[model samples]
Each structure stands twice: as structure tokens, then as C-alpha cells.
Target chain A: MAPQSPSSARAALFDVDGTLVDSNYLHVRAWQRAFREIGHDVDAWRVHRAIGLDSSLLLESLLGDDADSLGDRAKDLHMTYYLGARDSMRPLAGARELVRELHGRGVQVVLATSASEEELDVLREVLSVDSCIAHTTSAADVDRAKPDPGVIRAAMDRSSTSGETAVMVGDAVWDAEAASRAGVTFVGLLSGGISRAELEAAGAEAVFEDAQDLLDRLDSSPLARLLSL
Target chain B: MAPQSPSSARAALFDVDGTLVDSNYLHVRAWQRAFREIGHDVDAWRVHRAIGLDSSLLLESLLGDDADSLGDRAKDLHMTYYLGARDSMRPLAGARELVRELHGRGVQVVLATSASEEELDVLREVLSVDSCIAHTTSAADVDRAKPDPGVIRAAMDRSSTSGETAVMVGDAVWDAEAASRAGVTFVGLLSGGISRAELEAAGAEAVFEDAQDLLDRLDSSPLARLLSL
Candidate 1:
């Protein structure tokens, strides 16, 4: 590849929920509550595996034909429970610092997730790193979600960076797979419940324990190396 | 572009329903019956635009959040009504001839549609050109649907052709937009009730009155010119 000019922008694309925010189990609980409220008992493992998917896709993935009547209600219930649970929301270790660190080093930061605008507002308030975030690609902005590359591609487009210039950091297989399929570099964090092996199997370039671990190892990470490219 | 050798394989990706089989109006009626049965009344015009989308997405598009109870049942109801209505389904003019013409010239033909396998089974029995078809990509084979490029990409992959070497022929704006997004050539047909202006606006390379008109003009069409490249 030809050397990129300094003017060519670079992006650090982050998946909001599990990677930076401590919300994987929270989502699981919320989904459980929603399902129970809608008169269904979905397995927590299935919902965990579906963490990074859009709500509709998640419901379809888990319940398949059984989610018909409960689709909208389940989502509404999850959102309600989740919103009520938001007071307990917190960023994973160094989540805000990592975004700030990337921004400090002139890397554009973009959050690529399937959360709706209202949901993102809550997440943004919790993360408190809005100034560092250059752009956000949400589910409402795209027809589909993670593992399909639509959200990641949208983030790349909004960040004005090509896939090769973006490093996607997340804590789920969907994020890793989406980045891999989109030809973007994928950095994985174990801040979420997903295993390192799973993330790597999904095509993560590097895996860290959490945002703080990634931040501490930034000098040796793909984002730092790519910037120096 | 470099010239494609005569031996280099090419593919014709046909979107069933309105593009070849004259079932767009049939689908609208089925959807209307299903939605009405589920207590919502959606217009036929709304159903026309949602033709190329996946069934779950179609319900969401028409009824919005009101499609919760109808998502799975609406599909079941549509399939039930549609199966009964299949006696009227027939391939559009020259549909079989066009598939045969492409196959005669050594170009593989693949069907790219969001219809379920059961629905495709019904559509295939109606079209009765199975021997000429190289492969078929259905909604069940993909994680997402038209306008997302999953089905088109899957068709190209199944047919062993790159997007540039594949031509997507359909009769809806969603089909045109999907082909455009996938970087495949798009040929639009007007039999599906979508206007020529709409298809062209969505980036169709050529528009025909129907499949027969495309077959009659095949020698002068982009599909022919590309195959000869």
C-alpha cells in the first residue's frame, strides 16, 4: 500500500454497549425482563450471543417464528427496563480515556452500534466522552446492524475514512465480524462477556482485557501502528 | 476496463416476483389480506415498494411498530393466501426465454430474491425454468435483505461471479438500489408496478416494459454488451 498522507484522516470506531460501557449483562437482564413481560422465557445465553444485533434481528435470531406478537412489546419492555436500569450504567475501565486518547492523538473517533438515537443519548451521557467522539452511526441511520458491515460502513463514510484507515474496537463477535467483512481492522476488548478466542475467531486483530488494558498497550496496538503508517 | 475473455464466466442475477413472475400484485393482495386479518389495513402501493424486501422488514415497513403481532402471522397468512392464489401466477412475457438465452450463451443464471424457500418453491413451479437456473439465493440463505446487498452478493458468490461480472435484473427500486449498492449492473423492468423514473433514480442501467421487451432488445442491452466485453 502507498504511504497515506498526514491529511488522510484515521478513525477509531467503537461499539458502545459491551466494549466501552459495562452493559452486556444489563442488556441480558433487560431482555429477560422484556421477554418474561411478553410471556416468553428466552435463554440468557441466546440473548448474549445476540448482544450486538439490532433489536428486531436479535428477537428474530432468538425467538424465530415465536417472536411475532412479542417483537415490538419485547423491545419496548427492554428499553423501559434498560432505561430504568441506566442509573447503574457506567463506562468500563478507561472507556472515556481511550476515546479521548485516540482523539488527543488526532485519530477521529466514531461509535458504531445499533442503538437508537434515544438510547445513544443515554449512553453518551454515561460515557461523558462526547467531545472526543467525531461521529456516531446508529441503527436508525442504517437498514441493518453489526456482522453485516452496514453500520461499520456507515461509520467509515461519516468519518470520511476508508475501511483501511479505520480501526474498529469492540467487545463482541459481531463487531469483529463486521469489521472483518468490511475490510476494516478489528481490535477486541474482553470488557464484555465474550471470550478472546471467540473474538479472534470472528477476526479480531488484537484482544485486550478492557479499555484500560488497550489504553496501556496503545503504543503497541494496531491503532498506534496504523497512525504511524 | 480490461476485456473479459470469452471463456470468463458471467452471470445474470434475476429477481423473481415482479421482474419475471407476475406476482407483485398477487403479493400485495396477500399482504393486504394478511394485514387486515391481523387488524391493520395497508395499501397496495405500500406493498409494491416493499416487494423486494425481506418479509419481516416488509411488515415493519408498512405497519411500523403495529406489526408486532403480525410479523410471523402476517407472513404465515400471506403464504397461506398466496399458496391459494398461486393458480394465477405465471412468468412474465419472455421470462423463460431470457433465462434460456443467457444459458445458451454460456452465462450462468441465478435467481436473487428475498422470498422464502417455500415461496420460491411456489414461484419456481410457476416459472418452470428450473433447468436453466444455475442457482437461487433466498432470504433464508442471507442474514439481511435487499437494499442491504446480502442476497445479491450471495447470488454472485453462488454463481461464482464478481459484482462487476454479474447483472441484476429486477422491477423494483429496492432491487435497483441493492444492485447499485453491491456494485452490480442493474436492469429494471416495469411489470412490477414501480415506475421507470423510480428505478432509474435508484440507478438502473436500463429499463424495459417487461422481460419480453428486455429479451427482444437483449442484443442491444447492457447485459449483452458486458458479456461480450
Candidate 2:
């Protein structure tokens, strides 16, 4: 056979904090607890908007100039508080099975995330499908986070998947922004704080309620082909 | 008294890993070590090319098909091994003082990086000037890392700055590529693995030895006028 074109190999990249896992709410609670302890009043909804963004950017946006004043102490507190809640973290409904199914089919399944190694550990533990995920990304790995296509491109590059053949699945405008920048298809999930309108506006080709919804409607969408088993 | 034009308030963004800090060699070693233990014979120099990418992409590029097989255990090892060497990490020459001066002068020093919180903590401790950096990014913040501008844009957003007034200073091709994507000026540094030709090819506007060199010649460069204090 002639060599495969760069577009022949395809990959499906998923965001971990929300789309593939039900950790958005947990993150909100953790940030809420962290902020409250620091004597700052932050609404869960507001923090939710900041989810999917890099942690420092999220904190800086939420805390404003106070973020600078709080510095490492605040970051330390946020992580410390979040670690305490890690025991309860779980994969979003059908997420693990979906990833496993895709991996089984030889379609690369990567968890491209903004989570740190410590947080990735918690996710791996909670998901219990480490072997099933082809790759897991962390902040330590890339320069820019979501809303940038580097991670998605990285996933595509790793799997030898081309931008045209790859799809990025996530729950935030940032994911859509990234997929758009990478020139790939973006499938949005509503399990996170973002609304359908926001995801659509962010350039999602389709929006589903969560991993389960995407799974249920897989056959009806392009995701089925990209994530096919 | 009136609101300034967008350009008047623009800020300069700096990439930390290779641009401001001299940690690329350390990262290459860590990844090389991680890849070696996982039964792969990866060239450290090759790994250096993928330094600014997120973990999934890095692993994918380094491990290829074996990435799916090695899975998260290998990722865990990479993090564990990288963390072990964090203590010896340090900033590139004049990096700390330069970022501090920029911040002090209201230049809005933002660190765009792919490092996770744990890794960032190590870098922050080594640099010892966490309070001065306007923003610190990681893989978690972006859906992608460099060669993509999500983190840089986020930094601009957080500081209420814009691309016209912003400049991205770093030592790698990814940094230059990202700045190009974000519509910002890119100032390249020689301390990192990449060369001036490579940086310029990736879209860097000028090249310098490191932060100190940039600072030394700031007054005569377009960057000085753009930075506007």
C-alpha cells in the first residue's frame, strides 16, 4: 500500500476538567472554599466562568489585583483545598467507556487538560482507565493553555493525526477557540458551566449535554467517525 | 483624563521556560530520562524541540504509537522524575531582575508557560520573584501550548492589555510562533535551545542573549517605545 497521507490517521482529544469528567462543579467548590478562606467573596458562577482557563489566569481574573497580592500563598491554598476534594472526583458519565471504546478502535484518545500533575493523578485515580487513555496533558507540558490550539495540535501531532482529521471535545469556549485555531472540528459538551450558546458562539460544530449524550448521539455526528471504535 | 487608546495600554508578555528561565536543558534531561526508563531511545535534542508543547503532545511526539501502550504510568514517571530535579532549576541570567523591573515600571510582566502548578512552583521558588509576574500560564490554562497564542492572549486579557501594545519574549520557535498568532511582537532570546535564525523564522522581531540583553538595549529598540514604561 502507498504510504498513508497525513490526514489518514485521526485523533480525538478531550478536555478532562469538565467534558470528560464531572470535576467542574468540584473545582468551583474548591475555588469557593479557597477564596472564602482567603477572606475574598467569589461567587461559584463567576468561578465557573473561569474554569477551563489556566489556574493562574483564572485566579488573576477572579481575584483581580488581589491575585498579585495573594501570590503563591493563594495558589498553594487553592491546590491544597482542591487536593482535599480529589477523592470525590469522577469521570463524567460514559466518559471512560467512550475513551476506551475509541482507543480499542485505534482512534487515539487523549486527555488534553489544564490540570497539573497532582490533579492529573487524581483524575487518573478517579477515572480508573489510565491504560485506556492514549495520552494525558498537563500544564507542565505546554506554554499556553486552552483557547490556544497547541495542546490539540500536540495531540494531533502525537497521533500523526492531521488537523482536518482530528476533533477536540470539551466544555468551554476555550476548547472551541483552541479547536478553531488548530483548524479542527470542535465538539462541545455542556457538563461544565458554559452554555450551549457560548459553546456555539465559540465555534463548536455540535453541542451535547455531556459525554453520555455525545455517546448516545455518536452515530448521528462527525464525532462518531473520528472517535469510532 | 479620558480613556487611553487600546495601544496606549498594551503590555509585553514573556515566556518563562526558555525565554526568561534557563530550564529547557533540565526539561530535556527529565523527558529523556523519562523516555529512557519507558524503553524508548529518544534523543534529548529531539525532545528539546517539543519542550514548550503540552505533555500529551510531547509524549506523542517522543513515544509515538507506544504512547497509547505506555499510558499514564509513563506520564507519572515523567512528572515524578521532572519534579525530582526541580530543586536545581534556576532563572536565566538577569531573568528575575528584568521581569521585576518591567513589573515595577508597570509593563505588566506575564509568564506564558506550559508548566503545571507543581512545576511552576519549583520555577517560582527558584526565581523568587513570583509577586512581580502579572500572569503565569501553564498547560492547564490553555487547550494548547505555544506556537499557539492562547496563554499570551489570556495574559493580555487579565492585564487589560492588547496585542498592539504587547510583545512576547522567549527563546524558542514555539514562543515566536505563538506571538505571531496573537498579533504581538516577538523578542527572541539566545539562552534557550533555539537559534536566532530559527526564532526569526518562527516570527521573532529581534534577538538578544537573554533578558539582560533586552533590558540593556531597551531604550533604542522599538520594544522600548512599544512597552512605553
RMSD, every candidate, angstroms: 18.8, 19.8
Q: Write the per-residue lDDT of candidate 2 for residues A1-229, one digit (tens) a residue.
A: 1114455576788888877666665566567667767777554345666788766678789888888877467678878877886644557777878887667766777787867888888888888887777677787778878777778877776667776667889988888998899898899987664667678888999998777778888778667766442
lDDT of each: 0.80, 0.73
Model 2: DockQ vs. true structure: 0.01
DockQ for candidate 1:
0.01
Give stretches of model 1 more than 4 Å off: A1-6, B1-229
| Docking class for candidate 2 | incorrect
Per-residue C-alpha lDDT of model 1 across residues B42-155, encoded as one tens digit per residue:
533346567878666787888898778658888888889888877657677788898888887878889998788888999999888888888998878888888789899999
lDDT minimum window of 10 residues, candidate 1 chain B: B1-10
What's the true lDDT of residue A149 in model 2?
75
DockQ class, candidate 1: incorrect
